[model samples]
Target: MHEKIFEGFCISSFILNKKLKVALTYNLKPEEENSFEYAMVSPLSKNSTTYNDTFAEWDTIETVNSIKSALELFHNVIMIEANEDAYEKFKKERPDIVFNFAECAYGISREGQIPAMLDMLRIPYTGSDPLTMMTCLDKARTKEILSYYGVPTAKFITAENLADIENHNLEYPLFIKPVGEGSGKGIFNNSFIQNKTELQQRLQQCLQTYNQPCIIEEYLPGREFTVAILGNDSETEVLPIIEINFSQLPSGILPVYSFEAKWIYDTRQNPLDIFTCPANIESSLQEKIKGIALKTYKILRCKDWSRIDIRLDSKGEPNIIEVNPLPGVLPDPSDNSCFPKAARAAGLSYEEMINKVLIAAAKRHKLI
Candidate 1:
């Protein structure tokens, strides 16, 4: 049991020092067999605010279970479903810390809900705070904040209406994504627009699909990579960067990774070959990527851990695409979540990565 449990972990004083009650809170998606069918049958009335409110952002039951086990390895663990009843559970648990993975049920501020609530409860938790969560969820806001810090990011324009994009100065071959979504929501093959007609069509699709403003950014035509950062301040460390390699993808796949590429296609047989850890790049390039990632981390005031997506500009320079404070930690190895993949690349097992996040949060809260 010890060998299997601690395979990717080492005994640390942090765990040996003390054992405290830790709350593992997550919003696990319902695993109904007809979930998709139910969604398809639902009325798509324009006035219905529920339309597009709930996304695939919720965690899976297995993921929550795996996280619970990891937390239990070093501390007393209690499960808290992040929902209307969360307060009741919190009162009962009174945990020493909260390991948060609740992406929430819906809204532009979905990811911030739980963290914001925890703030009111005065309970310490893992990952970024409410303000940071909301800011990072809005892709345009993230770019603006990074740009203000002189961080390199692809030039972007937010379009509330088609007219907002009129007379835009951004170069052609732009990328279109919902301004306030994560997990590749609303990003499809047509996301990469090289012509005005494609741009107009894709923008309309994003606007109609998400019922939110879309961001039109001067697309980075070079390599794309995601870097994971853990720890706070001087202790912060950038995990091994994972490059999204598309060579194994079927022919005619879009140059840009979209929702279909991430969730629909690349199944068990082919699997998702998009991840290539310890990316092949010059040492100088690696250093440059890490430096920019750390700088962005500090500027954003992100705590615990985060996964930053970056792509190269035409000049082979790295630019921040989006910063994800609540990065997915899918437990299954077959799942192509980047944060866990990067942790695995750094020789940390999935269990270890999860616990490290908890420990980091604990340290940040001055707990044990």
Candidate 2:
């Protein structure tokens, strides 16, 4: 049986109202020598479409704005560009906390890059630790851990190249996605494959596009939902479940949440209309989703905050699709971002939600 309470850790809190100095961090992907665009926008390049955004696609200004909005209520917050120089600067300044949002620097060790730096500097930061970040980056590894703990996830196989796909006995109608990406980076309408021919084609595309291993899992063609978990491991709180309503999606497009649907600008093609918080599903199913999400969070050692994506099978049972350690917090009511929506459903204002994370971390040390 799973333990009801998290163990092996002691909680300590820092002094309250100490004028805590906080730093909000973001990353700039190193310019790709061969590709014309940065690493974040490379997928859109294939379609000959330029990915446009408010701050040139994941720029520091937008990231800082999001951080400032979230941290303003807690203490004096400073925004810093995540880099070697920035790390040095942060050490010199010595902030009380670092709001780490640096997903990656290049095509290299993306998530571990910044947390590793923070560790070397002995700086405290929000979100997952470097170990958790590294483990979660490789989707296959995360799934393996979950499965080892008997957590419910889809049958999946990972391959570094096309030759790897030939040896595995994976089920049909598989979902192909990059093994190490977030924000639905490489997922698209064609990501769901029905037969060997299409599977090989998608596999080749994934291998060429990501230049990394790909995870192919048996597709769960049913309702899609997301559950957000907050607080620390010992006292974590499960937020309301959110569902992706694909009823309005154009036929032929797989119900899978794709890059186009996630970041593309086209309204008709985007699937924003399909998202609903406190997902209108059966109470038993909601409880199941909550239970599975909490289990994944505990097994993965995810702390502070995390989001788990799930899908319901034809039998209405939930299957773990993916785990998001650092989810987006865009508060624009029109955007339909899951983190803030879940926060609102849990009775937190935008400012309160941001402060709550810091409070949770501070209270761990008795700071609050």
Candidate 3:
């Protein structure tokens, strides 16, 4: 019995040193009178308010307290907000590791910006590097790379403006989305188009609303499954696949995982809306999904951790959708998201999951 337990170990230990210095980096709310005011008055209990109030908009004291709790296993964790002078601060007191969670600030690069800064500084951080982060942010670019790597993905076209769709070759029933935004931003039920006129109209709306190129892809009209990938390269592990059950979805809806379906889970109060991890799927299909996720993860050169969004086509083949380089870490038991959910399925709690990722990075540097 003891040998059976010992057999489960990987027989390798990379992290040998004591707890390393870690900086929990996050982006501060851009300093503006209106932004600051909105932060102050936002409802603290609301889920939507959590993004602004809980992380970026919260007072420094609140953020520091939160970080301390998250990094309870570490020896020292310094809280650093992403700002103009943050790089200098990082240089002066370079931490052994950086827990980068800077989503964005004031309509800037948001996700890729801080990672790029860290790349230049040569500081070790969790998550994908700058290039992968930038490519994945632009869904079009991500699909293109996946395609080049022979990964199956839905057919898509890049529409720079309304005029560009005049002679486009995309199929009917297309899904329009912002080229670089996430969290279902700029995606709504109206994004589905069945004809040329609706396509042009939605294209115009996306252009005007997002002020950026709109990506148009053929709607898969099939089940949506998300695969959560952890670790890097040979050591990588694929968590149980998550299948988004849309049974609660209203009839006639094409089942787009819209912003509301994701962020408003508790408000809807529907258990079916939640993610069913280790989704009930055939053994063959499960293997297929795992293979696709692993292929996409490697093709993108994603490191430390990442999550791949996938959808099954009419023929029941897994097609690559989008890659999330920096998945959210909302530890609120009320809002346990996918990344953490998968970690729990793997027998790791929130704190253990965080440390596991840090250890993965340390293994890469042979500095654990």
Per-prediction TM-score, please? 0.90, 0.86, 0.84
Ranking of models by lDDT: 1, 2, 3
lDDT values of the candidates? Answer: 0.81, 0.73, 0.72
For every candidate in turn, the CA RMSD to the true structure comes to: 3.8, 6.7, 5.4
Sort by TM-score, top down from the best: 1, 2, 3
Off by over 4 Å in 2: 1-15, 28-60, 265-271
Q: Which candidate would rank higher by TM-score, 2 or 3?
A: 2
lDDT of 1: 0.81
Clashes of each: 0, 9, 2
Maximum-TM-score candidate: 1
lDDT of 2 by residue, 108-180 (tens): 3667777778778877778888778878878899999999999878899988878888877877888898898
lDDT of 1 by residue, 9-104 (tens): 345425546787888888766644446323312334756422332456776667788999887877898888888888777866778888998887
Residue 60, model 3: lDDT of 31
Q: What is the lDDT of residue 224 in candidate 1?
A: 89
Candidate 2, run of 10 with poorest lDDT:
1-10
